[model samples]
Target: EKRAFLAQSPQLYKQICALAFEKVFMIVPVFRAEKFDQPTHLNELRQMDIEQAFASDEEVMNALEECLAYILKEVREKCEEELEVLGQRIEIPRLPLRRIPYSKAIEMLREKGEEIEYGEDFSKSQERLLWKIVKEEAFFITQWPEELKAFYAMPYEDNPKLVKAFDLIYRGLEISSGTQRIHDPELLIKRIKEKGLDPKNFEFYIDCFRYGSVEHAGWSIGLERLTMAITGRKNIREVCLFPRDRKRIFP
Candidate 1:
């Protein structure tokens, strides 16, 4: 398959399954061919993806926040010796993590002397700055501009230009990203075109919605980035046994 590419995420497939199953989750390795040389960037990585029908972004985010807290508590209590080996200490976040709007985040960043333009994704430095302002190990940034989000992200009701999406930022790193998906076939097509993507190529996915589909939302967690945060590691490669970044391909 000369044209075949590795799976970047289980998002699309999980969304499809959620139509029939109501809720679905998957944990698997994913690949990205992007050229990134950052400490946390990787060409191949693992992720935890979850999808649910009839759920709003807020509902899904609450679930994910609780999940993270539970995992962190367990690791703190159960992996004492292991953490000692790595000289890492994890702080379990409190329930109902703090949430900030993207607009507010931009304002905060600008106040802090960080030059950020609207509708553009935050840079790594900007993420760190916002994390400091929130004063929490984990926080959510919601109401992202629609143009900055994926094609499936549902635009906001009050302002159609912004999407009902949120990013889970942990310890200055983006640990998860998700949104309420556009369920209507017509709306999905419009979003596809808005994102400058071809609906014809996404026909298989689009056709599924034409029959019947429920409002759905989901998020995917970057396994390495999560590990890096939990372990207080500076680089994502440290968490993986065999890392694959912009340069490395083989052991």
Candidate 2:
């Protein structure tokens, strides 16, 4: 019997390479089996995944900010004509996009008349409202509850209940999400068990931390989502030449 899965993201592979490379990046096709037929989702997509060793989530966030600014500048100069066709314009985001803690964001939403509670993930409409409240095209939401994040996310030293994870929200959508990963093998196994997952099933990945795994952080960006944000496309299918979703599979 074959034991495998269609890689949903290149997260594990990039982290494995970071063990020796220190810094690594990849853009690859990722597969998902979601049943959603939304305008912004597809069964197959492309993702840009990055991993870096001996880095904190804060350091990686700064690097990501610069990377996004550069991308916006390049698109403005190189794709002006194309953008015009799509009736869109790229607004170069400012450096160090605002950072709002998960708790504060919830408070802001409540003040603005949203009934969201702490530890709850934001829905699509809620994300839109949060973006409007901040009035920034790009911003970050950090300090998510540990239970809300994956077991690999590192917990805050001062607040073990919260993880050192973040989400990059752009124009009412989440373009990326990342965190400082747990590098201690024992802690990693503990977290896996806490999440009700069998650590034995992930023996290979867990073993990578047994010897000398270094502290690392990383994030994944969606190419389709970026395209949608830049071109002001309401639907992801508009930008994708051949989007594969629940209904369509062949060109």
What TM-score does each of the candidates earn?
Answer: 0.96, 0.96
Could you report the Cα RMSD, in angstroms, for every candidate shown?
1.2, 1.2
Provide the overall lDDT of each model, using Cα atoms, as 2-decimal numbers.
0.90, 0.91
Write one digit per residue (lDDT tens) for candidate 1, span 7-107.
88887889899999999988999999887799979999999989999999999999899889988999999999989998987888887898899999999
The sequence of per-residue lDDT tens digits that candidate 2 reaches over residues 33-83 is 999878778899999889999999999999888888898999999988998
Flag regions of model 2 displaced more than 4 Å. Answer: none
Give the per-residue Cα lDDT of candidate 2 at 211: 70
